[model samples]
Target: MSDKMKKGQGPADEEQNAQWVASRSLMNVGSLDESGYLNSFYRQGYNLSKCLSESFANAKDAGADKIVFEDTESYNRIIDNGRGMSRDDFKSMFSFQKPNHSDRKSCGISGIGGKIAQCILSNKKTSTTYTFNGDEYLVANAPWDRMFEYGVFSDMITIDNMNQYQIDMFNARTNGNTGTIIEFPRNDDVIDVIKQNFSRNNKDDKQSKMECVYNPCDMINVVFGGFRLDISYKRRDGEVEQMQMYDYFGEESEKYYDGKTTRTIEHYYDARKDISRYILKADDVQDESDMEIPRVGRGYSKDPRKVSAPYEGYIKKGEYVAVVGQRHYTDMDEEPPETIIQCYDDRKKCFYDEQFEEGISDHRAPLYRNGQMIGKFHCSDVKYTNSRANSKSYHEIKSVQLKLSYSTHCTQDNLLDKCMGIQQNKNQFQSEDMPVNLTRLLGYIKKDKATMIYKYFESIRTQPISPSQPSEVEQPVSPSQPVELRQSVEDSMTQRSVNGYVTGPLTPIQVTIALGINIGDLTLETLTRLGKDRHIIAMFNAVNK
Candidate 1:
């Protein structure tokens, strides 16, 4: 791959591929088909693919990994090593805002998952999958009828001899030594667009150009050396900032891209914690860090992994943190810390675009990879997203005006619950230092630390995405629209209900229930009014249990 990229093209040749020249404007401005459908599904797929790849992109370290965006019009994605779930995880991946997922850690947030991807792509879910280790597996959204001779499935699918490089890669990746692959076929025009839009531009400063036009939000994609935690200024606004650790971190860091000079900073004793982070406005940065805080942006988490429920020992943690980016990255196989805290999306207010609630809060944290989504931190993420740069979304959702807020502090953000909304008390975590055991709670007190921790996390509903990102999450507005699209999807980016979580692919019904709703009644005012207007318990409730 590296040889292909390097030997393939240089500046002048790269310039020939218009895809590199066109900025972020291309994201939102896609070609529409005669059917009025958005024909630029390639960009949509690329956008989603980027997020998926990012989860494993950094190679799980602060240095040594290399993420090189290539010029090839057609590229492939590989998903390997997830032994048991190779197939289930593939099926539920879709384009819906905060769609519920099988792996909920990196992606499971309220409003930042597959659903958001769907919204970007005109509410569509166009994908194909194959599972073969000799035994037949399910398949979806492919043009198998035209190409394959035969295939088989139990319930919903089958296609045979469905040869595609994409599927081959997926298969190879899945089987570890072997796996299945699924690729969406691109339209002829899209092929040109992909080529023209995403060229092999090894321009002068890959740093300067490793940006998505307008969505300057992409800027943070380059901030991995040491992320900027700008929440301090606003955090001091109320009494809130005092106990919060979202503004905490390590010192001595640098930000670099594949082909650009590096940016460095010394945050050896920074107050912010490692997990949750924030940005600094120019003035704020100058005042505090003695440096000009570049224009930063927030990325909502859009991972589509579902959270597993609270089993005794299955505690899991995920972080979509861009340990690597356009410049400096980790080696291909470094393992990040296995803490259960997820590294993407908001915990309190999952996937809520600040615009709906009105701007300027620490909600969206600008995430990076030479400032690219690497597919992890979008204010939203899922099946697909726009590539048109100059679209009205910027003004519609101004940068300075909106933000995504989260917390590593745990206890801070979910103010209503006072538990682990942001969960700052590291003491609560099961560690050797505490010298305390959860056995007393179940057996000691006397449960086990696992149960104790589960209850603890559940009580506060630790949000997955950090509060360091600018955020403004409030209750849903009672808009006159027909019962707003029920939150059918789980945000691979939203925070989970502290203790329990959904582990595998969820049915639409399961997702709806997890979101606490019944899709059948979305349009019914009677159901809406009933929830809005609750009746007294009347003391008659004591009978059943």
Candidate 2:
């Protein structure tokens, strides 16, 4: 054999006499569809909220430590005291091909987020002023909306193109020379959305005014690298009101129990897997009075038991925490059928659910991705099983905020892939594996550790009031009921229960058939108000025997 062959390079490598032939196939290059290109930006789930979120992300990426949001009848503005953009940097915002920020801490995945936000808000009429060193301030106006309307995307900007109005607005809003100010023409819809989502009743106000819900100093250790955010809005009476930025993490964390005490689970990283996990579990359960009083703003609710339930979970994967807790299966019974809020007006609905409620507390911890709130953290592995009928040892995890944090050469590519999984607008996650891994992380607790953690939380609950000692949960399945019939009944009950039908009174077996759906679905009011028919009564009687 040839030396090259012996070395695993193959005999072909030694064929110096061989002449290589090159072949090519010709294909037509298609023309760009300008309309479709413009439409693609809108399709990415950008609404007023997401646009604002992108603005904040841009500021954060620029190393901004302080951000201010201003809303008035004339215009809306976002001013950030960060390392402001240079002229080239400002120009890049208009480029379709400009790459997203490569910084690991940056939320700029698509270079076009800021541009798209501008076009969506002001169309072609957008104004921005930026300075790199607080020395020479430059203001530029881009016709982004017009570019979309004409299907002619342009990145060219003149450094001296500021008009008198733009100059005045820029000077009025800009403070330090080393900062950026983004302004778009007044958008009433945007203003209204800000008020709706960010406002909360202030108990201290004699006139019962709603204040902004943000707490700037809260959760500084984690989110946005601890940036300070301030917000102001012009009231209808021409008075300016300063509102606090909504503090999703801090408020949601404390409210896990009594809105007073929270248990912080230290960070956990699996070096073997190159993944990091963090959790904030509720240390104590709510007392009776705590459950009945509804505070204002997010996480404020009367009957938190009905709102969040005993052991429910919530996941947040976007800019803000959801206003309502997980829809209580128990409260549905007492709630009048007519009172159930649906998206009556189709126009009011966006890609995300927007039904606002009084409270932020939920049975589960809100989920976050890279510090932004997303969705709920759920695990099928932590559930009760018929095989372990006598054991109540399943992890009673109150709420968890799961995120991905990894810093390693081998895992950098994996993190890149995870970043790509985020949708263009960054509203929610589309990655299938991302969630599966997070779910596995939830089960990372060792059997002993799980027991220890549960006992610790139980001790906290016992401090305020005596909780009933847990006895072995009786097996819910009845030996008399045919296994096949019971399975069929379980399936039927599950489907019916989901559609809001009351399950017949089948007792332990029914409970065993569906743990979450059965207890959550069946309420005293539902039992009396709905399932009184003879068919249900007969089934109920049949199952008990």
Q: Tell me the alpha-carbon RMSD of every candidate.
A: 28.9, 16.8
Which stretch of 10 consecutive residues in model 1 shows the poorest summed lDDT?
A: 536-545
lDDT of 2 by residue, 101-194 (tens): 6446455655677777877776456555444445555677666666666776644344554466655656665553467787778777777655
TM-score of each: 0.27, 0.52
For lDDT, the strongest prediction is 2
lDDT of 1 by residue, 1-545 (tens): 35534664423556543553464244645542322222332333334323322222222211213222211234222222222123444444332232332232221322223222322222233335444543444344433232222321112233343457645544543433333333343333323222222221222344424431323221222222233211111111222111111111121223211111112221111123222211211123223222211212342222211222122332222111212111112222321211122211112221222111212122232322222221112232211122112112211122111111122211122221121121111111112221111111111110111233334323332322222332233233333323222221222213222124324334434333332345563322322333321110110111101
Q: How many Å off is the CA of 450 in candidate 1? A: 42
Model 1 residue 298 lDDT score: 46
- Give Cα distance to truth, residue 219, candidate 2, Å: 16
Alpha carbon deviation, residue 2, candidate 2 (Å):
23
**Which parts of model 2 are misplaced by more than 4 Å?**
1-31, 123-133, 155-168, 201-227, 234-370, 374-377, 380-420, 431-435, 444-453, 457-545
True-vs-predicted CA distance for residue 169, candidate 2, Å: 3.4
